[model samples]
Target: MSVWDSIVGQQAVVGQLQAIVSGDPKALAQSWLICGPPGSGRSNVARAFAAALESPDRGLSDEPTNITRQVLSGTHPDVTTLATNKVTIGIDDVRQLILTSEQMPSTAPWRIIIIEDVDRMLERTTNVLLKEIEEPSPHTIWLLCAPSAQDVLPTIRSRTRIVNLAVPSTKAVADYLMASVNPALPAERQFDRHVAVRAARLAEGHIGIAKLYASDTQVMSDRDELIVGLLGLRKASDAVLLADDLIDTAKSQAEADVNRQTAAAEADFRRINGLGEQDRIPPKLRGAYNAIAKKDEIKRRATRRSRDVLDRALNSAASIYRDIAVLQNNAEDAVGLINMENRTAIAELSARLSRQEVVDRLEAITVARKRLLGNGNPMLVFEALFCALIPGRL
Candidate 1:
């Protein structure tokens, strides 16, 4: 399939990008701001654009060429991807990006730079990028992806062409997940279409989450357990234990993910330094390796873990309030439940709590979410949220 085919429910975006790649100078821009909600495939579309820019000879071919494959896999030298795992993208990071942006394309028509979370940069950091982005080399192209144009600074927003991506429909997400199934797998190993639809509905049109729910049994089970436990919080003591349990679950998931990432980082460092089984690093380079191994990477990874775990847990928790709101307002016909399988439990909550109480709980969740996103302590945020969730009883 064409590279753009993988981006679902953005036919207009695909058409525009295809035109630009096919020598339509009218559609070309030195810098582009791609705006979309999380899991709306902003980065994927940006990468596709980069690949197309680098592979003009491929000409929208159904099969991916080597250039397209390399760009997608992040191995193409001409394409630079700056993705931050930290709380903020620092001025130094922006300086490095600016430095690289001035370099001419090594092997492609454009030296494409893709910044995945441009919204994470501080104002000062963004200011550092303003000049370079506004006056990039003729052969350099900048692609910035964020939740929305509003997330970025006005200076940066004004200098770039904006493209918005809409969340794909449930059918679109399900169809894409099923189509992505490996053809080499046997019938027994293949995912059922039924599972795809259920997962898509549960994920609320988030393609990444939908695929995880469809493919991973443990993820599905954990989500069910979390939702069930949330609805079962009746007593004050029960809320405490459940809140602790939620924190523990998030910690465990975070630790597991962090361990895997650390291992991968270590392996990559070893390969890059050409360290063998017995060879010792030179004294001069020892400090550098240690910094990479222990300091910078570990700190960044920890920050990432905290943010990811908190965000995941909060999202799941928020869904309970969302489902309750839907039931309380008799809007079930308009919006589907993310936890539809636990409808009985949700219905029980709706019967017990008034519409205003449900709305209040949602407000608590929203406040907690904002605090966590602003680097508040996860445990503190969860404690307040959990207590508020069971108001009178807690």
Candidate 2:
């Protein structure tokens, strides 16, 4: 299929990129910024745009060429991508990308650089990148992805053409989920239409999240448990216990993710060094391996992952309260509810608590999220949130 096929509910964006790819090469800007909400496929759009630019027929053909395939897989020689899991992108990383940007394209018509989460870079690092963007090489093209233009420095945003992508409609996302084959699943397996529709609704227009909710039964169960637990809370002790449980779960998930990533990195390092799975590293190579397995970076990544897990839980919690508020205001049918499966529980909670109490709990969730992001103690933050969520605690 065509490279753009993978992108869902973005026909206008595809059309814009297609026009640019088909237009005069000399008139194209050297840098572009792609802005969208989380799971809205900002990174996917960047890669698709890069593929189109490098495609033999300029992405007009029905099927992707080999160049398009390579670009999509991120194995193309002319494409450089930086997609980090860390809390921030360091200055050194930007410097390295700058060096890569100076080189001429080895094979393709343009040397493309795609940086996902550009907002993660601090001002100093962004300044380091600004010079290159301000005066990029003639054949170099930069594609930056962020949640919004406001996330990046004005100097950086001003130098590039901005493309904004909106959240897809619920029906659109549900249809895509039903039609798309998840590579992680068995070839013979497909998403049930009912499940896809529910996932799309729960995800609130986030395609990545909708896929997760559809494919992973555990995620859906955990969300259900959290909402149920919140509704069942009747005392401060219960709130404290749930907070501890949440923290422990977040930590366990983060640790597992870090261990997996470390194992994969080690395996890749061994393969690159011509060593087998059971092979021992030579003395000289041991230091290099140690450097690759820096403890600080691993710790930071784990912390970030833990925080991410908790943040998602908080978002889910907020959605539950939002649904309750909708029911309280008698707008359930008009605006619809995110967690339709939990409508019974939400409706009961709506009846138990005052409208003002629901508002207080929602505000508490917003504060908890902010404090969590600000490096506040997660346990305390969660405890406060849970306590506020207790019915009539306000």
Q: Of the candidates shown, which would achieve the greatest lDDT relative to the real structure?
A: 2
lDDT tens readout by residue for model 2, 272-351: 99999999899989988886669998888899888877987998898988898899888988989998877888888888
List residue ranges in candidate 2 displaced over 4 A.
Answer: 187-190, 251-304, 351-359
Q: Residue-wise lDDT of candidate 1 within 301-375, one digit each (tens)?
A: 666765665676678888888888888888899977878888898888888888778778877878998898787
Clash pairs detected, candidate 2: none
lDDT of 1: 0.82
Off by over 4 Å in 1: 181-190, 258-303, 391-394
Error of 1 at 322 (Å): 1.7
lDDT (C-alpha, whole model) for all candidates: 0.82, 0.88
What TM-scores do the predictions have? 0.86, 0.85
Instruction: Give the worst 10-residue stretch by lDDT in candidate 1.
Output: 181-190
